[model samples]
Target: MKVGVVDYDAGNLKSVQTALAYLGADQFVSADPEELLSADRLVFPGVGDASSAMRVLRSRGLDAVIREFVSRGDPVLGICLGSQIVLERSEEGNVDCLGIVPGASVRFPKERGLKVPHMGWNQVSYQAGHSLFRGIPQGTSFYFVHSYYTQPLRADLVLCESEYGEKFCCGLIAGNLAATQFHPEKSGEYGLKLLSNFLYWDPERNL
Candidate 1:
C-alpha cells in the first residue's frame, strides 16, 4: 500500500520514513499536494514551533489540501507537533490549526521544579479494541518531547492519558484520523508495534 509522509518542511520526516521502511511499507516523503493526496495513507508528523509550522503549510498550500484529503475519508496520523496542529487552536503562538480534531493545545504551566518540556519515555493507558493500540499491552511507554499538550474538546475521542504534572490526553482516535502527542518513531519496540497497527488499520471496519 502507498503510505505518504506529509513533509510540510517542519517534521522529522527522515525518521518516520525510516520506520515505515523498516515496516516494509511503500512510502514516500513529500510537500507536494498531489503527491500526498494520492497516497493510500498519510502521516502528518511535525516538530518545532506551531506558528511557523502553520506558516510553512499555508505557504505550500498544504493546509487546504490536508483538509480535503481527510474529507475523502483516508487515514491520517499525526505525531507530536503534527498532532497538535490537527487541533482547533494552539496557545503556543495563539495560532489557529487544522480543526480536524476538536481541541486546543495549551502550554504546560511553569510550576516550580517541573521542566517546561516533558521529555523522555512515559507510559500510555488506553481502553482496548482501538486498532492503533491493538495487541499492544497497556502501560506501554512511548517517547515524548514537547512543552505543550493537547486538550481535546471531544473528551470521548481520547484513547490514552499520560501524566507530567497532571493528566493530559496522549492519544486520540476518531473515525479515519488518529494522532498521538508522543513520537512513536522514537519509542523503540512499542513504537514499532503502534506504527504497524497504523499501517494496517481499517477505519471503516473499526467503525
Candidate 2:
C-alpha cells in the first residue's frame, strides 16, 4: 500500500521515510494537498512547536485535507507534535487545532522535580485487544521528547498510557485515526513493528 508522509514544514519527514523504507512500504513525502490525499495512508510526523506546525498546516490547507481524509474512512497516524495538533486545542501556542478528536493539549508541569519536556525511554501500556499493539508486547519502551501531552475528552479514545510524573495519553485511537506522543520512528525494533502494523491496518475493520 502507498503511504503518504506529510511535509507541512514541521514533520520529521526524513526519519519517517527511512523507517517506512525499512518496512518495505511504498511511500512519498509531500506538502501538496493532492499528493497527500491520493495516498492510501497518511503519516503526520512532526518535531517542532505545535502552533508553528498548525500554521504551516493551515497555510497549505492540510488541516482540512486531513480531516476530510479521516472523514472518508481512511487511516491517518500522527506522531509527536503531529499528535498534539490533531486534538481540539493546544496550550503550546494557545491555538485551536484540527479537532478531529475531542481533546486539549497541555504542558507537563515542573512540580515535584518533574521535567517539563519528558525526554527518554518510557514504557507504554495498551488497552486490551488493541490492533495497534499487534506483534508488540505490552510495556514496550518507546522514545519520547515532548513538553505537551494530549488529554482526550473521551477516555474511550485513549488506547495507551505512559507515565511521567503522572499518567498521560501516549496513544489514542478514534475511528480511522491513530496517534502517538512518542517518536516511534526513533523507538527502535518494536517501533518498527508498530509502524508495520499501521501500514496494513484497516481501522474501520479493526474497530
Candidate 3:
C-alpha cells in the first residue's frame, strides 16, 4: 500500500521518511493535496508551533484534504504536533484546528517543578489486544517531545495513557483515525513495531 506523509513545511519529515524506508513500506512525502489524497494510508507528523503549522496547512489547503481523507474511512496516523492539531483546538496558539475529533490541546502545568517540554522516554499503558500494540509488551516506553497534551472530549477515545507530572492521553483511536503524542519513529524497536502494525492495520477491524 502507498503511504503518504504530509509535508506542510512544519513536520519532521526526514526522520519519518527514514523510518518508513526501514520498514520497506511504499511511501511518499508531499505537500500536494492531490498526491496525499491518492495514498492508501497517511501519516501526519509535525514539529514546531501549532499556530504556525495551522497557518501552513490552511495556506496549502491541506486542512480540508486531511478531513476529507479521514472522512473516507482511510487510515491515518498522526504523530506529535500532528496529533494535537487534529483536535478541535489547541492552546498553543489558541487557534481552532481541523476538528476531526472533538478535543483541544493544552500546555502542561508548571506545578511541581515539572519540565515544560516533557521530553525523553516514558511508558504508555495500552490494551495489549489493540492492533497497534501487537507484538509489543505492555507498558512500553515511547519517545516524547512536546509541551502540550491532547484532551479528547470523549474519554473512550483514549487508547493509551502516560504520565509526566500527571496522567495525559498519549494516544487515541477513533474509527480510522489513530494518533500519538510520542514520536514512534524516534522510539526505537517497539516504536518501529507500532509503525509496522499501522501499515498493515485494517481500520474496519479496528478495536
Candidate 4:
C-alpha cells in the first residue's frame, strides 16, 4: 500500500523511509497536504525538541493538515516526537499538538530514578496483540530514545505499556491511528515487522 512519510523539518524522514522501503511499501516523502490526504497510510517520525517541531509544523500549516487527515479516518503511525505530536498537548514547552487522541505529553519524572533519555534496547511487553503487532515475538526488545512520554487520558486507547522506573503508555491506538513512543526503525526485526504489519493491515476488515 502507499505510505506517506510526512516530510517535516524536525522529523527523521530518511530513517523512516529506509525502514518502509525494507518493508516493501509504496513510499513517498511529502509534506504536501494533498499527498498526505491521498496516502493509504501516514507515518510521522521525528526526533529533537517538541516545541521547535510544532513551530515547524505550524509555520507550514502541517498541524491543520494532519488534523484533517485524521478526521478523514486515515491510518496514522507516529514515532517518538512524532507520537507526541498526536497528543492534546505537551508539557515540553506548553506546546499544543494534533489533538487526535486524548492525552498530555509529559517529561519523564526525575523522581523515578531512571535516566532521562531512557535510551538503549528495552523489552517491550505486549499488553495485547492485533494486526499491527502480528509476527512480533514475545518479550521483544525495541529501541527507545526519548524523555517525554504520553499519558493518554483514555485507558482504552492504550494498546501497550512499557516499564521504565514505572509503567507508561508505550503504544496507543485510537480508531485507525496508532503510535509508539519507541522508534520502530531502530527496533530491529521486531520493529520492522511492526511496520510490515501496518503496510498490509486493513483497518476496515480489522485485518
Using all chains and alpha carbons, the TM-scores for the candidates as numbered come to 0.96, 0.97, 0.97, 0.94
- Pairs of colliding residues, candidate 2: none
> Where does the lowest 10-residue lDDT sum fall in candidate 2?
198-207
Candidate with more favorable, higher TM-score: 2 or 4: 2
**lDDT at position 114, candidate 4:** 77
lDDT per residue (tens digit) for residues 1-207 in model 3: 999999999856999999999999999999999999999999999999999999999999999878887899989999999999999999997999888889999999898699878999999998558888898888889999999999999987897999987799999788899999999999999999999999998878863
Cα lDDT tens digits, model 1, 34-137, are 88888999998999999999999999988977787678988889899988998899998899998888989999888646887999999899857777888788
TM-score of 2: 0.97
Least accurate 10 contiguous residues by lDDT in model 3: 127-136
Better of 2 and 4 by lDDT: 2
Clash pairs, candidate 4, are none
Task: Provide the lDDT at 9 for model 1.
Answer: 80
lDDT per residue as tens, model 2, 151-205: 9999999989999988999988898899999988999999998898899887867
RMSD of each: 1.2, 1.0, 1.0, 1.4
Span of ten consecutive residues with least summed lDDT in model 4: 122-131
Comparing 1 and 4 on TM-score, the stronger one:
1
- CA lDDT of 153 in candidate 4? 95
lDDT of 3 at 195: 97
Clashing pairs in 1: none
Judged by TM-score relative to the true structure, which candidate is superior, 3 or 4?
3
